[model samples]
Target: MKYYPQLTKRQAVSALEEFLAERAPALERFRQALRADGRDPDTLLDGTTQGLVPLWGWVLSGLTGPDAPACTDPATVPHEDWPSWERFTAETEAILSYESVQLLDGFISYLVRVVEDRTPTAQWQIGQHPNKRYQFRNHPVLAGADRQIFFPGPVASSAREVVRGRRAPANDEMAGYAQAVIEALSAEETRHEPPEPLVEVEDLGDHPIRGREIEVSLREDIAHEYSRQVDHMVKTLAMEDGITRVIREDREVLLVATPSWNTTQLQEWVTQALRDAGNDHS
Candidate 1:
């Protein structure tokens, strides 16, 4: 391979601006869909991590340059000629899913080693679903028949928790942590490795759905909420998966390593108190 002259930082920046310009209309369409759905812009659950917007802004501006529409007015761009919203959304989800898997793979490998004596090993293959969900499955660290770890939430939440030693907030507290993670990652010179290019799978004529179909199901309300989450899971997959893995691994590590009888005794009493409360309520 012949070496080409490296572009200066300024030239690279100029090229990025042009790219964002072309995607301006697509971004506007996304913003409109969010507004039409009455979604809160501040909701971290939506995959809008702290520095994500700024980063996207940088991306758009860098790619599209001055030719791109003003960032303030997503409405200025018309949606008539825009791509199908569903397709755009699916692609966005695919991008999220693809990135999440790689991050989870590296982060979990390091974390599990930190908490356990065994060396990390290859356990899962990363892949994307048609719905654009990502997974790192078939890992021994997960302790299952398949030993898989699935990340089904937003990348920001997962990244923040892993890099910052925190978990996603249930309410309003520590809301900025997600943003902090994005900013921190954005400031870093090295970018996370991009996922391998997506591959197309062909449907075979003999293929059939083979899983056992269960007659029983959850109540209507429960099912509806579950469906809603499934519909929106591209946003929350990473964080949810990471938090779960950390808690389980942390508990196991603590049990094995914490040798203080006094501390264990106090924890046992606390556990008994909580169990007693549960029994009394029942």
Candidate 2:
């Protein structure tokens, strides 16, 4: 409802084209180096026509910037193990799950700076379309909230494939800002309208416990305590009657079917669980 001076969709798309064109030589060099390594650039399988751009972005700063992390202590780190800037790419977590996120995010970070430099007033964010269930952890569009821009990129498809494996909870704060973002992204990649938030319910029609027995079961389960994440989630989800917490394998776990659970609630619940577990005895 207020006027903004940052990039519009058309301008953002044009800017991406310009950025890619300027880096065309660098991109070509990248492909050639990959080919020489016997790694076919065509089959990079980054789930984009752009080919290996994610990897290139992951190592872009090291290859081109003064801030490369490879400038480590020479005696402690072997020269042979140091990153070869000439190659234009280096390894990180090579799996798609990590690739679509860290690798693509690195590239997106580069793009954001480029966008910022060009449009001084611009602010950008890279994240999922919460309304999207078949979504990736990192979608290709760089959202410029100030000017209703979604600077789309090759990062979308492959990232989606990775996200399809494990769905994360939607962020309410993000949703408050991103409804228009999905509209500007490719139709195939986003929902036309935001979907109503849904929660999972278990029938428990013929299960072993019911009525007062359920409350007794819950009280028995609560005796074995967990940690901060538990305290945090209990404070968060204690009023959601549809949910149940139980100890499994000596650990606190929620008993609802994952797909049917409140994605946000379960996400907060389990994330803390994992964090608590990982910190256990450490």
Candidate 3:
């Protein structure tokens, strides 16, 4: 699957500047109003900020609370846990997806830095006294696109359509339709995965950057730990004809699959190594 790349520090700074430019005029006007009343500029944006708990975090936790059955270890059971278990499972069955899990995790990391750098008093003041109220309610980016469609409960449009096509068979038919609807919605939920965080580092080597190869080196400590994990996973995979070599001169590790193996296999092996070392995201 194709992925989007993360912006570099310079790129991120540029994006931030653009973002501020769009919003700054109104914000500054509001700030002036606040300042007239002796409010701080820092306080203005602080109020507007979403703070430590990112919107994505709230959505994820609400969907799957720690105490929820899905979060609980299902192997160990107490009769009393069944109720919570069933509830959590039902919700999870409805909403669990690769994208959902990724978004929940990625946004938590993104929000931590955002919140730490923000000045709370400024954020509060900006939010309270903005020249125009910023209403993020129902914003598409804040919540996933499907948020409105399958809300409160899974959508039943397809099921309803199917029911209308046939002669409804009393309670049994309705129950079957309900089951079908649940399955369809669950499938749909997982169909849309969250966008992976993409990082585009400049390749310093030649050879056309073959099949997702990036010529880069990590910090010494991280590289050491990753080298160990990569070795371990490589053994577990038990595939011969592939060589894992640490190219100290290049300051990067290189995994080479002999020409006897197809490109697909080589890519998969390298991908697994990146994932195991948690450098896939890096």
Best by TM-score: 2
Model 1 lDDT at residue 134: 26
TM-score, per-candidate, Cα-based: 0.18, 0.24, 0.20
lDDT of 1 by residue, 1-282 (tens): 100112222222333343234344434444443455564433512333333344323222222111224422222334332222112222222212322322233222222222222213423232222332323211111222222332222323444343343543233222343333323333423534343221111111121342211111112332243344322321332243221211111111111111122333423432343334342211
Instruction: Give the C-alpha lDDT of model 3.
Output: 0.33
True-structure RMSD for candidate 3: 21.6
lDDT of 2 by residue, 170-272 (tens): 2232222233343333223332534322221122222445221011111112325444545554544545555554322122333342223444555545444
Q: Rank candidates, TM-score, best first.
A: 2, 3, 1
Q: Which stretches of candidate 3 lie over 4 Å from their true place?
A: 5-40, 47-114, 117-252, 255-257, 263-282
| C-alpha RMSD by candidate, in order | 24.3, 19.0, 21.6
Candidate 1, overall lDDT? 0.28
Worst 10 residues of 1 by lDDT: 245-254
Per-residue lDDT, model 2, residue 254, is 36
* Greater-lDDT candidate between 1 and 2: 2
